[model samples]
Target: MNFRKVRHVVRREYLESVRKRSFLLGLVATPLMMGAMIFLPFVSEGLVSQEEMRVSILDRTGRYGAALIADASPDLILTLAPPGMAEEELDARVAAEVLTGWILIPEDFAETGECTYRSGSITNLAVLESLRTRLGLSLAGAKAQELGLPSEDVESLLRPAEMRTVRVGHAGAREGDFTQVYLRAVMLVMTMFFALIPTGQILMRSVIEEKSNRVIEVLLSSVTPLELMVGKIIGLGAVGLTLLGAWASVGVLLSLRLGTSLPISGGEIGMFVLYFLPGYFFFAALLGSIGSICSAERDAQPFLMPISLTLILPVMMGMAIAQAPDHWVARAFSFFPPLTPSLMLFRYAIKEPPAWEILATWTTLVLATIAMFGVSARVFRVGILMTGKRPTLPEIARWARER
Candidate 1:
């Protein structure tokens, strides 16, 4: 409970972490890596050239083949294969890189509306969809001509309607899209991982190293285990903040350069900061406890693996959140203690959650953080001094409940 001792511990831990060459490199390199990863695809789009794809068509109908040949664009070239050419030969050509791919228009394509496409390499869905649309138009035109209707009339009948998405909430209607949801999910998950990992590693590594060196026995002579654990968590948490700041600054610069807006608004950014701190503390303490109860990093693996997977669960649900942000599953994850921060950040960006939900999520996180640290400190006190073997789960539980 000595404030002076806690401050000294904090100062030493922070200074040692910041002074490392790895830390200095991360301060510069991580941000640049983050920025490049986010923006480089967009920037490189104009610079990279795509070779036009040539797809051979086998027409059993013979009606739509000529229409497809005439409508071919600069990026897509459609050629009619010889009447007797085997599909096996065509597939071999595709495999040898002589052809990009091939499409087969069935005799019953107009009736069943199904056709087959084959490729040795990856198929481009955009190109395939384009080909389908063109074929559909051609069949419709042929049918219209037989009924003495003009091609323009058929085209008009087949035209697609436009629909724009708007999300309505207390703030009123706003333009919304799935892309924004995905971008926000990626940003939230990456930022959380980047900031949380180093701090957690520091907690674990410091605990393991100190135990191995028998330094905790010497340190506990001066300060209580609770104070030492708190000091380490705070010190390492500050170090993570530094990394987050550097990475965020560089990301902003890159976004500006790419003429791209960040997915989250100012308020969402504030909420991210709010949620991330407690989330980090919860995980850091859990990892610190694992470090304390184990003889080495290898000894921590069986325990650490579950925690790692739990943290990854929110990230794995990102695509589902992007598709249906307010679904019951997403809502459930948003309220879950371990996943609250990351999942809630995603929901906030997709569409603002109810205010009560936000409050509830934060309340759960705060309580979880406090309880986690309490348990962690208790385990650390006993396990930090025990070096011969890793503590059993029951023993660790006893330590937490010990007066």
Candidate 2:
């Protein structure tokens, strides 16, 4: 109820957090790390030494081995291995640093056309795909030229061609691109990953300290339990915002340095911050509630495990949705409250969600945040004074539902 007190507390919390060495280091380091994460890959791709990628092929197809090499890019190195060489020998070659990897075209490979790979190391997928595609094109071109017969027809067969790809949804609706949906999912999930754990730790530490030092008793005198809870949530919530803002500023600077465009707009950033604040407030309240219900840090374990579990779900969902953004299963995670912010962010980043879905998702989230606060406040009120024993679920429920 005291604006002055809230402001005072908020100022103190912000100042203290900003003064921490970790915060300072983050402010300085985040930009550089972000820059590297953005710039290095592109830089590597463009400016990397034009050393060829040598892939050895043991061919079963009498006519196809040379065709694959001819079709490859100038940067590719295609070597032919003699027949009867064991894969172990090839691996030894790689181990001895004489070769990178090899592919085997078995005796039946000419008929079935399947390829086998032997390697001491996992190769870059892009490189593998490129080799396979170029080889296929070269062999196809060879066959076409052979069929064309005359020199003039062979020239025609060599002409460059273009192709366009389109994917249709279930209704045959032209889903031009659902990548926005994908980007949104990726961003949201990543944001949560970077946001939740540290923020939750802040909440837990705040509660544990208060419980240990008995400061909650004094604070409860001046402000009601609800006020104290809200203040802590707001205070720590601001810290999370500050950390995210610093990280984002560094990201922007790095992107600029790297000449990489950030997919998020000012409007999107504002929306994300908007969503993130409420989401953290919600989770902070839950974590603080758990922390309050415990008598000591040791007692916080059983209570803390569920928060850990809740955190894990979204990461699990992120892995699943990365492959198929439009899958109903992915959509279901987007609506799940614990995972919603991350999943929704990813969805929005990849593609703008229909207005109704966005509205409905947050509407549910806000309601949940409100309920969590209520439960948190009760546990904080009852468990603040009690010590020596962690409150059981029934006790926490009773305290929360107390008249």
Candidate 3:
């Protein structure tokens, strides 16, 4: 608890991290990757992309169906079916792979216009819909002209009505960020994916490096158990923060330059910093405490995996959370401390949840962080010095209670 010791540990952790190669590489690489992801949409869009499709037509109305093909597009190559060719024949061609797809003009073509598409290989659902819609409209327009009605009027009647919706909270919200909300949810998931594994790994390796060489003996001789425990937490935390900041900055800059600048506010960034700090510190302390309790790296798997999986669940359900932040499952986890800060922070940042909910989420996590650190500090102090014995949860609790 000494200010001098805490300060000394913080400084030592920071220096050790600055000297590591992993930290340096992360700082440089994160921004570039982010930039690339951001600009990729702009760079890759509308670039001669086609499905490599060739289409054919069996026209019962002869003129109407052939006209539909000619106007289809540069992408669609419509070949004329020979006279007396049957519907079965066109179906056979599709099955034979002679055509990518075909639009069948039924024999009852003049009386009713129900054109169907036939393909052996699956048509891209989107492309199929486009063909059906465009071709249908083209046929309908030609029929309307024969009946002395404007093709435009018929099309207008069939068009979907445009709508405008309003949300009650957070001014300046946009429709585009619906995708972004889902995307940020995705990013939140991926960030945790990238983060928890490596961070836990670093914790494991740090423990192994110290344990394998008996580095603990040298440090234990000079510092108290509390100082060593706190030192490792602060040190690894600095490394995590440095890497996170680098990755974030990279992603942000790249998005701004190359990708869509998803309408993120200062509050969202602050929530990320605030929530990530607790979520990560909570896990880091948990992991570091585990590392301290174990004599070997392999020993950590028993404890670490359960905790790791619990945190990973929210990230896995990220899309579901984004779609419905107020869903019972999402809301329930928002209150659970281990999942709260990351999952809720992602939800809150994207949608800007109710003020009371945001306040509760932050407050609960902050309290949990304090409580965890206290217990971890005690377990670390008692266990770090004790060798060949792993402490249980009851032992950590009893040690904290006695301390």
Taken over the whole model, the C-alpha lDDT of each candidate is 0.81, 0.68, 0.70
Q: What would the per-residue lDDT of candidate 2 be over residues 114-206, giving only the tens digit for each residue?
A: 777766656466677776766555555656666756756754766658654344322232333444444444445555655665667666777
**Which residue pairs collide, candidate 1?**
none
lDDT of 3 by residue, 1-403 (tens): 5768767877876787678888677567644564465446545543423646788877766766666666667776777777568778778877888888777777676677677777875526667777777766676677777888776787685575777643334656455545545555545544654555566567656765676678778877777777776776777777777677767776688778986864455566677777777777788777777777788777777776778777667667766776777887787778888888667767764567787887888789888988888887777766666677676778767877876
Q: Is candidate 2 or candidate 3 better by TM-score?
A: 3
Worst 10 residues of 2 by lDDT: 168-177
TM-score of each: 0.88, 0.78, 0.80
Collision pairs in model 3: 31-250, 35-254, 38-258, 38-259, 39-258, 39-259
Off by over 4 Å in 1: 28-51, 82-92, 121-123, 164-176, 256-259
Whole-model alpha-carbon lDDT for candidate 1: 0.81
Candidate structures ordered by lDDT, highest first: 1, 3, 2
Each model's total of backbone clashes: 0, 14, 6
The candidate 1 region of ten consecutive residues with least summed lDDT is 42-51
Q: Tell me the spans in candidate 3 whose CA falls farther than 4 Å from its real position.
A: 28-49, 60-64, 86-97, 108-116, 135-148, 159-171, 175-178, 192-197, 251-263, 302-309, 389-402
lDDT of 1 by residue, 174-219 (tens): 6767665566666666677668876788779898999898898898
lDDT of 3 at 315: 60
Report the Cα RMSD per candidate: 3.1, 5.0, 4.1
Give the better candidate number (2 or 3) by lDDT: 3
